[model samples]
Target: MTYCVGVMLESGMIFASDSRTHAGVDNFASFCKLNLFERAGDRVIVLLSSGNLGGTQAVISILRQNGKRPDCPSLWNAESMFDVALLVSDAMRLVDRRDGQHLKKNNNGFHASFILGGQIRGEPPRLFRIYAEGNFIEAGDQTPYFQTGETKYGKPIIDWAITRSTTLNDATKCVLVSFESTMRSNLSVGMPIDLICYKLDSFAVTMRRRFDPDDAYFTTLGKEWSAGTREVFGRLPDLDW
Candidate 1:
């Protein structure tokens, strides 16, 4: 299992994903789930993927392979972020069609989902949650973010503190804290996390980082968040009942 999130703000956008993948309690490993397709001064697309590892990897591989062909309508030529989402959805469907039946017969899984967010030339930054079935929904003023896989544990923090107006810096902190909350509750989702912060209209990614287990900032942030949460809870008035 994994956790991936993307937030679109007035200033820009933030993307993050955990690297943990496990077959069982005794068998665990890490794989970077964050994928990027960037063309300086043209577009900056970020994909945070989750679900069946094979399926997600195949889908991403297909997108990358197709994006190189000028004859195909790929992410490189997509005029808008909506088009990019469609391209991703199409690639996902292609993978499902090829592997779904075989996986089902073996009682295996071919489910994969993605959070796609970025800026295409001319359009503002956009975010979408693409489902396993290849259909997707866009983030709007009311819902300016998207999450996939192991999402419930980290959602409350984002819901309470994030808004469309949140700054990239603050949003980055909120996102990391959300991940900390999730890792505390679920062992399957963990570090090292891949994070990217893209400023609007830059058409380039200026900031990207990987937070390993020993990463000082991430470690400190997690500790501070845990302590702060406990302190806040301690201050809450107790029930008389």
Candidate 2:
């Protein structure tokens, strides 16, 4: 399992993902679930993935290769982020057709989902999540972020603290806190965490970072968040019996 989030703020976009994947309690490994496609001042794209590793890898391989084929729809040639979403969706479907039936017959469901977001030269930064079945939905003012894989434990903090007006720096902090919240509660979502921030209209990745357990910022944020939660809890009025 994994935990990945994409946050869209008025200032820019923030993307993050945890690196753990496990087949069983005894079978565990780390793999990067975050991928990036950047074209300097032309476009910037980030992909956060969850679900079956095979399907996800297959899907990405296809899309990366597709970008080089002139006759087909590809990220490099797509005019808008929405079209980029469609290209991702189609790549996922192609992977499903190639492997889904074999997996299903063996009793493993063909499951993969992705959060794809970034900006093309002429468009605003955009974010979307594509599901197992090849359909997707975008982030908007009404819902300025999206999460995939082991999402429940970390969702509330984003709900309470984030907004479209959030600055990229603060929003980046929120994602770390959100990831910390999940890591504390779930073992399947381990790290070194992958993080990337792209300022709106720049068409280039603004900040790219990775946080392992010993990283100073990640360690401090975890300790502070825990202490602050306890401090706030103690400040509330006692409940009536």
Per-prediction TM-score to the true structure, in the order listed: 0.94, 0.95
Instruction: Give the count of colliding residue pairs in each prediction.
Output: 0, 0
lDDT per residue as tens, model 1, 1-241: 8999999999999999999999997999999999999999999999999988899999998889988898988889888989989988998888888999999998975799999999988888889999999999999999999988889989999999899898899889999999988998999998999999999999999899999888999889888878988999999999899
Provide the global lDDT of candidate 1 against the true structure. 0.92
Superposed on all Cα atoms, the candidates' RMSDs to the truth, in angstroms, are 1.7, 1.5
Top-TM-score candidate index = 2
lDDT of 2 by residue, 1-241 (tens): 8999999999899999999999997999999999999999999999998999999998899989988899978889999999998888888888888888899998996899999999998888899989999899999899999999999999999998899998787778888999998999999999899999999889888699999878998999888988988999999999999
Error of 2 at 228 (Å): 2.4
lDDT of all the models against the reference? 0.92, 0.91
Model 1 ranges off by over 4 Å: 230-241
TM-score of 1: 0.94
Clashing pairs in 2: none
